[model samples]
Target: MLRTGEQYRDSIRDGRRVWINGERVQDITKHPMFKPMIDVRARIYDMAHDDATRDVMSYEENGERFSVGLKLPYTKDDWHAKRRATDTVLEDIGGVVTRVGDETAGEMWSLYDGQDILNEVDPRFSTNIRNHIHHVIKTDPFHVSANTDPKGDRSKRPQDQDPDMLLHVVKETDAGIIVRGAKYETAAAYANQAFTKPTIANWGNEAMSDYAVGFVCDFSSPNLRFIARTGFAGRAPARDYPLSNKFDEVETLVVYDNVLIPWENVLFYQHTKAATFIRATLHRYSAFAFVQRNLKLADMLIGAALWNVRQTGLEHQPAVQEKLATLACYREGINAHLTAAIADAEESPGGLLMPNQSLLMTGRVLACSQLHHMMHIARELCGGQICITPDVASFEDPEAGPWLDKFYTLNENWASEDRRKLLAYARDLLNSDYAGHRLTFQLFAQSPPFAHLAAVYRNFDWNEALRFTHKSAGLSDQVWGDKR
Candidate 1:
C-alpha cells in the first residue's frame, strides 16, 4: 500500500536514538542536518499520491495501489516503469539523492534470487526473504542497505582482536539473535529498516561462522544508535551551497549493541555459501539504480559546463566544443548501458527480470571509474570563476557590493547577481566540501573500484572471446578435448 508524506513522516518518529555533531537529534523530521533529506524522501512518498505523478510512481495490484519502486520485476515493462519512476523523482527533486528507497530495495531482490543457497542453511531463511520482499511492497516503508562492518584490523582475525569489530551473531536466543557491531550506512538515521548482511567475499574452506549472518534490522529496536556525520545544510547558507543544503544523504556509523533480530527477520545464518553468494552477486539488480544516479550526475556536469561556456560566449570555440562532446560521450555511454541492459534483460534464477548482468556491471565500471575525470573536465569548462567567486554576503555588502557588481557583471543580460548564483552553484557542485564527500561516496559507496572490475570479470563472456581466438589461431581440437 502507498503512504502519504505525513504518514511517512509520522512513521519515523518512533524515538530512535540518533546523534550528530555531539548532540542527540530530538526529531529527525525537524533537525536541520537531516530534515532536508527526510523531506526529500517524504516528497517521494507524496509523489505517489499526487494526481500528476500517481500513474508513474505506483502500480495497482489486486485493487490495492503499491509503490512502483518496491514492486517485484516480472517483465521488461516493469523495469521501464521503475526507471521512469526514479527519473521522475530526480527531476522533481531537482538534484540527485541515491540512498532513498528504490536503489537499495533491489539488494533484497538479489538475496531472493539466492534462495537455493539460503535453503542449504535453513528452509525458514528462504521463506524469510520472500516474506520481507512482499512486506516492503505491502507496507511501503523506507528501506536501506547495511553492509561493510568497521572490521577494525585487516591482518588479525576477528577473534584475535575485538570480536565485535565485525558484526556477528553474539548470542542466539529463543526470541531472536542478538548482534553487536557497527556498519557504515547512508540514510540509516532516517530510514525505517535495512537489509543487513555480510560483506566478506572469501569464505575459504571454513563452514559455519558467526559472521555469516543476514537479517532485516528494524531501526526502532533498542540498543541501536545512529551516529551521523555532521551535515552541510545548516553550516552554510543555501544560496551559497544549493546542492549541499538540499541533497546530502547523510552517512551514519550505526552501532548495534546487542540488538535483537527475530527469527522472522533473519534471512540467513551460519552459512558461508550464503555469505559468499551474496557478496559476489549483491549488485546484480541494484547496480542499475546506482549507475542511473551516475547518469543523472553526468547530466548535471554537462548542464553546468555548457551553461558556463554559453554565458561566456565560448560555446562556438572548437576546443570548448570538443570538451562538451567528451562530456556527452560519458553521459551517453551510461545511457547506452542502462538502455541496453533493459532491452537485453535476463530472468533471474528466481524468475524475476533483471538488467543484463554483463552490461549492467560493465556500465557501473564505466560510470564510476570515469566520474572523477569527468568532474575535472567540467571544472575546466567552468573555468576559474567557480572557485574564486566571492560569497553572497560579500556581494550584498554596502562597500563591496558595487565593486563586486562592476567586476562580475558581464553584460546587461548577465547581471552580477545571476553571475554570483551560477558560480556558487558550480562551486557547490564541484569544489565544496560536499562535492569531495559526494565524489568519495560514489567511488566506494556501492563497493570499491576493484569490486566493480571483479563483477565485470565474473559476468562478462570470457569463454566466447577464448573460443574466437582459438578458432582464428586454428588451434588443434586436442587442446580443447582435455579441458572439455
Candidate 2:
C-alpha cells in the first residue's frame, strides 16, 4: 500500500536513537543535515499518492495500490515500470539520490534470487526471505543494506582481533537471535530497516560459525545507534553548494550492541555456504540502480561543463566540443548498458528476471572506474573560474556589487547573478570537499573496482571466447579435453 509524505515522516519519528556530529539527533526529520534527504524520501512516497505521479510510481493489484519500486520484477514490463518510477523520482527531485527506497529495495530481491541456496541451509530460512520480500511490498518500508563490518584487522581473523569486529550471532533466543557488531550503512539512520549480512570474508573453511548470519534489522530496536558522517548540508549557503546541501545521502556507522533479530527476520544463519552465496550475488539486482545513479551523475557533469563553456562562447571550439562529446559518450555508454541489459535480461534461479549479468557487472565497472577521469575532463572544460570565483556575498556587496556585475556580465545573455550561480554550482559539483567524498563514494560504494572485475569474471561467458579461439586456431579434438 502507498503512503503520503507526512506518513513517512511520522514513521521515522519512531524515537530511534541516532547520533550525528557527536550529538544525538533528537529528530532527523527536523535536523538540517538529515531533513533534506528525509524530505526527498518522503516526497518519493508522496509521489505515489499525488495525481500527476501516482500512475507512474504505483500499480494496481486487486484494487489496492502498491509502490512500483518494491514490486518484485518477474516480467520484462515490471522492470520497465520500475525504471520509469525511479527516473520519475530523480527528475522530480531535481537531482540524484542513490539510497532512496527504490534503489535499495532490489537488494532484498537479490537474496530472493538465492532462495535455493538458502533452502539448502534451512527451509525456514528460505521462507523468511520470501516473507520479507512480501513484507516490503505490503508495507513499503524504506529498506537499506548492511554488508561491510568494521573488520578490525584485515590480516587477522575476526576471532583473532576483536570477536565483535565483524557482526556475529552473539547468542540465540527463542524470541530472536542477539547480534553484535556495526555496519556502514548509507541511509540507516532515518530508514525503517536494513538487510544486514556479512562482508567479504573467507567463509569456506567454516561449516558453522556465528559470523555467518543475515537478518532484517528493524532500526527502532534497542541497543542500536546510528553515528553518521558529518553532512555537507548547513555547512555553507545552499546557493553555494546546491548538490551537497540537498543530495548527500549521509553514511552512518551503525552500532548494534547485542540487538535482537526475530526468527522471522533472519534470512540465513550458521552455514558458510549461505553467507558465501550472498556475498557473491549481493549486487546482482541492486547494481542496476547503483549504476543508473552514475548515468545521472554524468549528465550533471556534462551540464555543468557545457554551461560554463557556453557562458564564455567556447562551444564553437573543436577542442571544447570534443571534450563535451566525450562526456556525452560516457553518459550514453551507461544508457546503452542499462537499456540492453533489460533487453537481454535472464531469468534468475528463483524465476525473477535479472539484467544480463555480464553487461550489468561490466557496466558498473565502466561507470564507476572512469568516474574520476570524467570528472577531471569536465573540470578542465569548465576553466579555472569555477574555483577562483568570489562568493555570493561579494557579488551582493554594495561596494563590490557594481564592479563585479560589470565584469561578470558577458553579453546580454549571461549576467552577473547567473554567472555567479553557475560557477558556484560547478564548484560544488566538481571542486569542493564534498565533491571528493562523493568521488570516493562512487569508487568504493558498490564494492571496489577489483570486486567489479571479479563479478564480470564469474558471470562473463568465457566458453564462447574459448570456442572461438579453438576454431580459429584449428585445435585438435584430443588436445582439448571436451565432451566433443
- Scored by TM-score, the top model is 1
TM-score of each: 0.99, 0.98
List the global CA lDDT of all models: 0.94, 0.90
Q: Put down candidate 1 lDDT per residue, 1-484, tens digits, no spaces.
A: 8999899899899999999999999999999999999999999999999999999999898999999989899999999999999999999999999999998999999999999999887899999999999999999999999988898887877889999889999999999899999998999999999999987887778799899999999999999999999999889899999999999999999999999999999999889999998899899999999999999999999999998998999999999999999999999999999999999999999999999999999999999999999999999999999999989999999999999999989998999998888889999999999999999999999999999999999999887887998999999878887664
User: How many pairs of residues in model 1 come into backbone collision?
Assistant: 0
Pick out the ten consecutive residues of candidate 2 with the lowest summed lDDT. 475-484
For each of the candidates, give the backbone clash count.
0, 0
Worst 10 residues of 1 by lDDT: 475-484
What TM-score does candidate 2 reach?
0.98
